[model samples]
Target: MSVHFEERSGVVPCKTPWGSWYQTMEEVSIEVNVPPGTSAKEVKCELGSRRVELVVRGQQVFKGKLFGTTVEDEATWTLEDKCLIRIVLMKANREAGNCWGSLLDGQYSADPWVQDQMQRKLTLERFQRENPGFDFSGAEISGNFAGGGPDFSNLQR
Candidate 1:
């Protein structure tokens, strides 16, 4: 899989199923809206496509997913502006033989023993306050994040 940030939309893009086919789902997008008085280091996890975008406002935050089953495992913060956002998708098979369909969550967690959560949410507010107009992107839903896009250095890291 390949990952990078797009300049035009200020969002990150992650392409998967390298040199192969996965399913019918597209790429995912995760956008984090940085707020004020927040630090960049607070926010963890490399944002990808899955079309998941986490936005932070004054006292409320928004998060969602775009592709397959989403795991709820993630990072924790001590700040007040930070919150949890999870999106899960499942597919069920309908057959009448030994080879039937099954429903399962599709996500890789950071912990080897667990397959629930992966990344941690940071204080986007701090990052935004320090820098302005930070460009960000996310991963694709279920397809490869293919692109011949431009470089992203202007985005406030």
Candidate 2:
């Protein structure tokens, strides 16, 4: 199960048997693709604080523990185009900016590229926290970032 990482959206595509997933600092979105023309009534999705279960067409597609805890009450699932199931789960610890290594425990861990991006995000967040006067929201730190990035040391906030 190879996963394709999209740099712009930060989405890890199709690492699981069911589908793809992406995450923000606050929540995770899972996209499960079913056969075209499948009805919503035929899909059953169950979300818990540390687990998730999906059943399609009366057969269990996936059932496993999650990599991180989520707010069960805030989780939601919706059927799109009659074939795609979108699940959104709010993290229990959103303020921490914790990155999930994978959607399911012991399975589909993020690739090196994704992990690098996650670490970069975390570092940018820490820089923002340390220097509240500067906005790091759109900053991109790369190989030559130090040489090409803006000089903030002398900037007046």
Which candidate gets the maximum TM-score versus the true structure?
A: 2
Per-candidate TM vs. native? 0.20, 0.72
Tens-digit lDDT string for candidate 1 (45-138): 3233332333334332333343343322331223334333222222121111111011112421123211111110111212222344552233
lDDT of 2 by residue, 28-132 (tens): 888988999999889889999999999999999878999999999999999999989999999897642477778888776778777566656655654665577
Q: Which candidate ranks first by lDDT, i.e. highest?
A: 2
Error of 2 at 93 (Å): 1.0
Off by over 4 Å in 1: 1-29, 39-58, 63-67, 74-157
TM accuracy, model 2: 0.72
TM-score of 1: 0.20
